[model samples]
Target: MRTSGRRIVFLVGLQGVAWLLPAGTIIQQEEREPGTSKVKAQATISIDAGKLRMEQEKPGEGKSVMIFDQSKQVVWMIEPAKNSYMELTAAQVQQMGGQMQQAMKQMEAELANMPPEQRKMVEQMMKQRMPAPQAEKEVTVREKGQGEKVGPYTCIHYEVLTSGKLTREVWTAPMDQTHLGGAEFKTFQALGEFFGKLSGQAPKGTWELSGMNQMQGFPVRVLEYEGPRATSEWMLVKAEQRSLDASLFTLPAGLKKSSMEGMSRE
Candidate 1:
């Protein structure tokens, strides 16, 4: 769950390179429930080129890792507990979404032609299969001025509201923590853009990280809420830029890889 700080000195040499941080740049986030303030999960993220790897650690449960490679246009979910890994390409994910839409349309047409009694049975069946309509979503990110310090970084506050309810409250701090700047920081901005594209995108209403561009720094602390109660808080704990082996970005050896369906099997 921890990225070695010992390797960080090597990353300093990567300044002004095409890749902003070194390959092993590790960013850690820890989550804790609101009222109880109990730790729930810990996540470590490493990014290089078009590849992003997230390793999540839970107290009792086994570890899980997810890799999203923009160059390959694919996502992989890995469960070390089961020794299994699954892959989903961008095309495949979009195709699955398309199939669901087609099925819905076909069901609507059939219902339109059915008799009253038959329609009622079909409607009941549809209700069981179809998900309920989601509430109309509204996403807005508003700056809330200065925020309290988190660790060594001073933060700026911002609120992400959904349908007029507060969803995420963020404390952002400047990238100076990385000791990267000038041309290197500019390269990092470009890298962020590429990462955004690989991670699907923000829909019209979903505010998922929508206001990042407006902020001057990375979000160091994020508090998520369920209605008025705080669900959990995520904050950046440690960041280390270090040399990394390219092999880490690719699939680890001795693991079976398949589509999502295979995820449950292995």
Candidate 2:
């Protein structure tokens, strides 16, 4: 089934904000289309010490949980409806990267033996089918101004530019004012660095893990765009600094562990 463009933008907004979330806080965020008050998607994030859990729900995409354990350097993606979970570790990610490199080497060897004309044609087809590597763009962040109210907090407005074009507009409040712990904020920074290695291992229909290597403070509101057109808006609906249950960071008992090999086959 094909996914509509609107739904795709909604998912991107949800996941992008997840990367911006601070630890030791429970946050509820809603994503909406640019000109309307109607919510298109929403997510809840819980962060404690070095553990983080996010629950997200979409219209047709059901709910899923993502847990990142900094102590173990592992990430678990749970599908409640399927009664199963997928685990990713740093070592496993390294092994997969090695395998991909070997596969590329094999393909290159096969292409070398082909006729010049055939090789050119096959190369063109490969370029069309495979996504080319994206060059990293220079990202610059500038404070737009100060004292903007978002939800219950007054925030500082900032703009993020990529290659000199506006990419994201963000409003943030100081972590101290939000009453969230600063230790977890540092832990989340480490989490971002860790998951930066496992680039594409998250569930297909769910969120992708990304790092918040740039910009700081608790994000109160975020606006994402493509070129000049705004795509989606995310607002912090609720933020609480309270003790969360330990079980919220753990997988359910008796749940089957899904293997990466098995997942690839599907």
Best model number under lDDT = 2
Estimate the TM-score of every prediction: 0.69, 0.72
Best by TM-score: 2
Which tens-of-lDDT digit does each residue in 37-71 have in candidate 1?
57888887775555667788879876888776666
| Residue pairs with backbone overlap in model 2 | none
lDDT of 1 at 115: 97
Instruction: Write down the lDDT that model 2 would get.
Output: 0.71
Residue 261 error, candidate 2, Å: 7.0
RMSD of each: 8.6, 14.3
Task: Give lDDT: candidate 2, residue 32.
Answer: 83
Question: Tens digit of lDDT per residue, candidate 2, span 74-150?
Answer: 88877787788889887876777567557767988999999999999988997666523222446678888888887
Clashes of each: 0, 0
Q: Where's the lowest-lDDT run of ten residues in candidate 1?
A: 198-207
